[model samples]
Target: MKVLIITGGNIDDDFASSFLKKNHYDEIIAVDGGLAFADRSDLSITYLVGDFDTIDRTILEKYIHRPDICVHQFIPEKDYTDTDIAVKLALSLIKNHHSEENEEKVIHILGGTGSRLDHVLANLQMLKNILDEDVRGIIIDRNNIIEMIRGERVLKREEMTGTYVSLIPVTMELTGITLSGFKYPLENASSHFGESLMVSNELLEEEGRIFIKEGMAWMIISKD
Candidate 1:
């Protein structure tokens, strides 16, 4: 199942509407202040998680007693952030309902980035954990779609979300990096920390290939 987590971050209404209409989601989750956006958008939520600290009380009242929605409330001074809790819940739900025969599970996070640099970085770290569980996790905002990958992946032209595709090393070092069907191709290249070797690349063909032999990197598909 593909689950979507909406966190308490800056989300543009026009962007969110456009994004929602373009993609299909199996489950929707609202985290704390995200509940306000979910309510405003009239999205059918499967799970509501947060401490109700930043969310509007009127919006919280609307879904608290809904039988179809599962609410997971936490204390304001809890150890984990509301977004973290929501991600864990998504993973749990995916595990409980997933089957060997089912297609790959994916978690798409919206409202995950904003002015707060610390929160944005923390949310980015969650993608690595999701990768460890054999699931795909992506963080999406108005300008970018971020994902972490370790092995190899293909980027289809039609599925590209933005005009620019950039790769930033998540690990201290990355080796055996190869790129094909891109404007800037690389063969068995190596990149280290504080390097901008692979940034702002574009696909030259119908599809682009990226293979990383060691270490992880963030594939950011972005727009101006």
Candidate 2:
């Protein structure tokens, strides 16, 4: 199942609306202020989650009255952020709806990165949880698409998200890293925190491969 989560962060309406037009989502979720985006775009969402803080009262009431949508309301003082709760909920729904006939499960998060550095970092850290669940989670904005991975992954030039691919360690150290089909390739190299050695690499061939023997890392495909 492919799930889309819209959260309360900076979202370029043009990019986001265009994305929706080109993609098919099995489910769409609106989190707190994210409901505003859904309302503005006239998008259909299956689930609504968050505290009633950021959204307008009339809008919140309209969605709450919708019988087709499941509303999950939390207090503003809750320990976990609304996005965290939404992620857990998305995973649970995916598991329940999963079947032998279903394709790979994925969660795409929009409006996840913005002016709030703290929130952006926290959301990045949450990708690890999604990885642990064996569900692919992607944090995306207008300029960047981010994901966390361990082991190996392949990137196709045709399917490249942006102009550059950057690898940043999620752990203190990532060991035995290898890169192929890249502008700057590496073999059995180790990268540590606060290092920019693997940044801004480009694909040199039709397909690019990344292999990590130990530790997880963030793969950011970005544009200027």
Where's the lowest-lDDT run of ten residues in candidate 1? 95-104
Point to the candidate with the largest lDDT. Answer: 2
RMSD of each: 1.2, 1.1
Please list the C-alpha lDDT of all candidates, in the order they appear. 0.92, 0.93
- Model 1 deviation from the true structure expressed as Cα RMSD, one decimal place: 1.2
In model 1, the number of clashes is 0
Candidate 1 lDDT by residue in tens digits, 17-37: 889988787889999999888
lDDT of 2 by residue, 16-101 (tens): 99878877988899999999999999999999999979989888888987999999999899999999999999999888984566
Model 2 regions lying over 4 Å from their true place: none
| Residue 10 lDDT in candidate 1 | 92
Candidate 1 Cα lDDT to native = 0.92
Per-candidate TM-scores read: 0.96, 0.97
